[model samples]
Target: MSENPYSYVESELPRLLGNSSVSGVYKNKPEDFEVIEVLGFSPEVVEKGQQHWLRIRKVGVNTAAIEKQLSRALKIHPRDIGYSGMKDRMAVTEQWFSVQLPALQSMDWPAWFAEHMHAEVFPGGQVTLLEAVRSHRKLRRGVHKANHFRLRLKAVENADDLTQRVQQLVAGGAVANYFGPQRFGKHGDNVGQAMRMIQGEFQVRDRKLRSILLSSVRSFLFNQYLAQRIQSNLPYVNEGDVLILEGSQSYFTVSADDKDIVERVQSGDVHVSGPMFGEAPSPAKGRPAELEQHVLDQFPALYEGLCAARMGHERRPLWLRISDLALTWPEETVAELSFTLPAGAFATSVLAELGQFTEGEHANSTE
Candidate 1:
């Protein structure tokens, strides 16, 4: 690994890290912070319709918070409230959850969710529980629009230079798509730990969780590969840019130099590209390009996201193309704010763009 590991030596018996191992897994300090808000609204009525969703500005709080409270006058498991995605705990986010209120009709759904979830309505109307239904496959992962973010950086120097760079890129529509700093611990502990576990470099007690964390490590490296690409300034390669599409280990290159390919990749049609990890990557190459081809074929947009991620992490672009983020910044003295980030991006990337913040003296802030 190119960096130091963040995990503490447990008398030398290393284990996979959790929230505890990560010092301030979420960054604190008013100076090196940024805030992003997520807000969504639903219609005012449960009018019989095919749509079955209620948008909120927050996530991960659990359906019970909203559903149980409503049960103050009814009864059911919060899980009965089918949510499309899990959101951040700190940010004000909006999303949809399904209700089984098919036989009942009520004009009072808004008051119930607001009073229960403590979420403020941002748009649409109210919690519109659709009365109609549609036949479709059961909800799967990554099915909704992640939260959109707004960020502000701290310790900004040469703002004009940074702004000019971003404006020019936006005008020409180019940005380095790199993984955010979150991929590496202040050092590279997260990466190291995940790598060891995946390669059977350690003696893990749990087979299932160990496997899951190993997968996360693979995902992290793919981001690293993309990050490196962004840092290399290859997104706007000669002619235009190059989208290195990976399927399994075989890479098929797409010349983004063409304006249309660039537009589709940039406008969210096709996310940027990065290595696809079929198996764990060696430490030297960061396990890049070991990706499975069949899987990559499914997420065409993921390639584009990696591209943006590469750029976002490298240049620390301000105008975000990411759909979700959770940030904290100097909104006021002695006060810190928190929120949730959707899957596929980093909150720290948002902070890096807001401004460069030196790691504070606090132990928690170090990671």
Candidate 2:
């Protein structure tokens, strides 16, 4: 068997944007990378509620650090704090967090936190409270609608044709959806650690840590499957493709005789998806199945380990659509970019196609 073409790190992965010539520096400072979380629905404040949902903007801090600070300040258990997703540690991010306070206790914690933020007392970085609401339920994972990114790439080199590259991406409408390097941990070590855990060499007692490892393994395989499709020059809409409905998780398999599959894909009514491997058999058949199996065959141990762990079956779209993409150059060597992506998509994946980037000093830390 041939060695896998896709690397665990995202930058080494095949780019659908063609040649990778542009080189730049990423996240030079916290201000250079900004993300604004957009929650779909507004939570109403209730008179008798324990959950305090707060929207906060933090510079140079990860989501968990804020949760820990809140727990310490409120004298509550760490589990009492909840968040939708983990925001990057080295960036300026605005996100929501919910703290479950005692229903009978009325301490005005939000006001207290806002004051502390203004006082700049927190150790990690500066945090400012944007909005706060009282609710009865805790915030859950994957609840955010989307994230808007504002990025500034410094010391950009060989970017004379950057505009044309962005145009090509805009004309193509989508980029190959690969998990960001952050997902695989520093230097893409999570997948290797997951394999050790699978082989009984590493024992993980923490449930959260165990889940992260499993997820990394699954993500690695998914990237491999997507890479194979791209390398083969396969069209997004193809026979036996498992199509995911637009704006939904629901999916259905298309038969070879399905005449309208192309139209549905082009109309943005559906998307071609790749297997999220687990114990359950893949619904893909024909060429799609062949492609998935080819990837699975390359890593039988990883495949069997996932099955033994009984990971849930899921599907992620093979293509990611970039929305409201805009770019501007502040100087000859500096580029500013802004775009919005649906929840669970990575801005780094989009950036990988635009240029090869070296992480700035602070960006080396884990989120």
Candidate 3:
């Protein structure tokens, strides 16, 4: 077996605010990190429907584990359990889930779940049903609009310095949209697995697991490209860059001479995009394209494997805007931060710009 070309090391990436002397600890307890899922649209309600939508608040529980519990209690196929995205097992998080039952059939699901899956009796952690509604549609992944985060950093080495860093990020209104450590799995074994899969060392028959491994490959490549862009001090936009319109996925390439494009980017109407690495050629041109190609050439196995697997081309914004960012000192050695991030963005990315933070037990994962 060959050495994996991509070894995800968090320290290797440059922080926008540079290194800080401050350090802190987070996820020390379940309450230290909280996430609330924001849905894009409210599920349509019906008196009796095949789909049951539930809003749940859970503490120190894996989202998948909850799905299994529901499956057994409801006696439904595991595939019938649907969630927008995975929430961290170590944090206190509230998110939605959907279970499909026979059309027009009903059972007192809330009471059933309350009796069988209450927080006190739940095996691994606590789960409380917040709301229940009947809907015609089953919840799907990536349907949530955003995630609101409340984080408390304990044992802060230098709260004042951390405050300055937060100010810097708030001023910029954005941070590098790096996929947090969660995406690569523990110690980047996911990327290593992807490499092995590419070499035919093994095959992944499970579709969900397969998608994760492939996504790790693509995320790894994007991080590499973004890291180089930061190192080179490349502007978010450059000639031959692909720019995505705000609030939409539609994107188009632009030339350096497109003077109006720069103003738009500055106004947050368009964002510079980076490749997700798939079968189609990268839409980037000029310097951006050159930098991306440099990153791709170093990972032949990953690139070729993704193409062979037929992953479609996609682009993610190079910058993630932080909304309603606020910070407060709760104690001499503690600081709290609250912010809202659009769907698919990681809160840890914001914390990365401030100081070195150590996680407690299971607190490192994102919801």
Instruction: Kindly indicate the candidate among 2 and 3 with the higher TM-score.
Output: 3
What lDDT does each candidate get? Answer: 0.37, 0.84, 0.86
> For model 2, how does the per-residue alpha-carbon lDDT over 255-353 read when each residue is reduced to its tens digit?
968898888887789989999999999999889999999989998888898898888779999988788888899899999989898898888888888
Q: Each model's TM-score?
A: 0.49, 0.94, 0.95
Q: Best to worst by TM-score, what's the order?
A: 3, 2, 1
Tens digits of per-residue lDDT, candidate 1, 250-316, equal 2223443354765554554444445444433212111222222323444334333334223221111
Candidate 2 vs candidate 3, lDDT winner: 3
Query: What is the RMSD of candidate 1?
Result: 11.5
**Clashing residue pairs for model 2:** none
Candidate 3 structure quality by residue, lDDT tens digits, 1-367: 2254566667567876788888988999888999999996888998777888999999988688789888988899988988998898878899999999988687776688769888766556788888988988889989899999999999899777988878876886568899888899976678999989999999999898999999999999999888888899877678898999988889999975688998899789998999999999988898999999998788877999999999998999988878888999979898989999988888878888777888876655743
Off by over 4 Å in 3: 1-5, 362-367
Q: Which residue pairs show backbone clashes in model 3?
A: none
On TM-score, the stronger of 1 and 3 is 3
Better of 1 and 2 by TM-score: 2
Q: Pick the candidate with the highest TM-score.
A: 3
Point out the worst 10-residue segment of candidate 2 by lDDT: 1-10
